[model samples]
Target: MSLTKIVPSKPIKLYCSIICPWAARTWIALTQANVEFEYIEIDLKNKPEWFLKEVNPGGKVPTLKYGDDYLIESAVTTEFVADLLPEAKLLPSDPFELAQSRLMADRFMEFVFPAFRKGLYQGDVAGLSAELFDGIEKFEPYLINAKPFFGGSDHPALAEILVAPFVSRLYLAIESGLVDSATSTKLATDPKYAYFNTWAKNLIASPGVVGTFDKTTNLEQIKERLAPK
Candidate 1:
């Protein structure tokens, strides 16, 4: 597997909101790829007409404008950027390894993300936290040999990039007392999750991961959204 340098033919612009985990995924990917681009922050509550009509008909953030072409959805946009900058090695070059990375990300998104969201928004913190732990238990074996990332790379891989945003949010939620302390302790100290704990700590400490995360503001918005209406 060889890496190819990415030379963008046109300017890149990223449409994103810091509060959105999905948008944060694309932001992290762009930074990891070392791609130069303009950042356009969107107000989700008051979405602009131009953004809706032109950028994304669905009015979603994390839209990528590559020259005149626009791409939506965080996963697709992240993969597009990774594919564009093969030299970054964000995604594995080998087909099998790349598929494994994608599979891990898919499983996290399908299992853990929903449970985490339910815990955050629905006030079922304890039950959902247990459910989340169960999901993580299932995911732990995949990381047995993964030193710092699921791709078995020293640096973050596509799987980490996809999941780190939510993990960061979970950290914030725990700090803010939105998630129970028992769950947090288990996640951090349990022998079963030692590998995942290390991977998560490294991911959170990574350059683009924390930089792209606005913990204070994002936590506030999450609380507001989860507040009784």
Candidate 2:
């Protein structure tokens, strides 16, 4: 189903931080959709006082200031953009399909990511590798028919956009030896994950994902934060 793009008369402003995965969700969506909007980079460490006072009271990135209205939370902002720019085909128009796509994304965020963080930050490579493979396996069925993306779209949709950031981070961590090297090898060579690996490779290489991701900086930051004193 084709959706007509609704160009808002009011100016759109996105406040984001490059290192933040949540902020990356909105950034990737907007960039992929080719929507024109003002980009406001935020220093998460020392967020501007005005931002705290005038924008999101919680002082988080990925905040959307649309005209005089404000929107918070990554998922909300990403879906809102997808809705506003239907021409971008950011999401599926069919209700059931859209719901299914969202369900996949929700499951990844709720169950998969926490497991990833536990292994990455807590020095649990064995557990992390096992849990990651298990989590990744669950999503394989979703991509069983994917032609390199969710819903068989040529390009990414909302579901891919939502999870790209975390996937990028985790893959990077794995390649950098933060996770077990064997896990990365399995992702490439294992027949069990063939579908997922294909989709993940395409996602990481996609323009919206690669252009917005600063790999060198993020890896360094992760190393520094997780470095033992």
lDDT (Cα, tens digit) per residue for candidate 1, span 1-229: 1234245768899999988889999899888777678999999989999999878998888899999999988889988888887777897777888787778887777777776677665656665676877788777655535776665687787778989899888777766777777877887788987777787788888887966998889888778756767
Residue 223 lDDT in model 2? Answer: 74
- Model 2 CA deviation exceeding 4 Å by range: 1-8, 121-123
Candidate 2 Cα lDDT to native: 0.82
Itemize residue pairs with steric clashes in candidate 2. none
- The CA lDDT at 43 in model 1 is 94
Clashes of each: 0, 0
Per-residue CA lDDT of candidate 2, range 34-91, in tens? 7678889999889899999989889998999888999999999998989887878898
Cα lDDT, model 1, residue 69? 94
| Estimated TM-score for each candidate | 0.90, 0.91
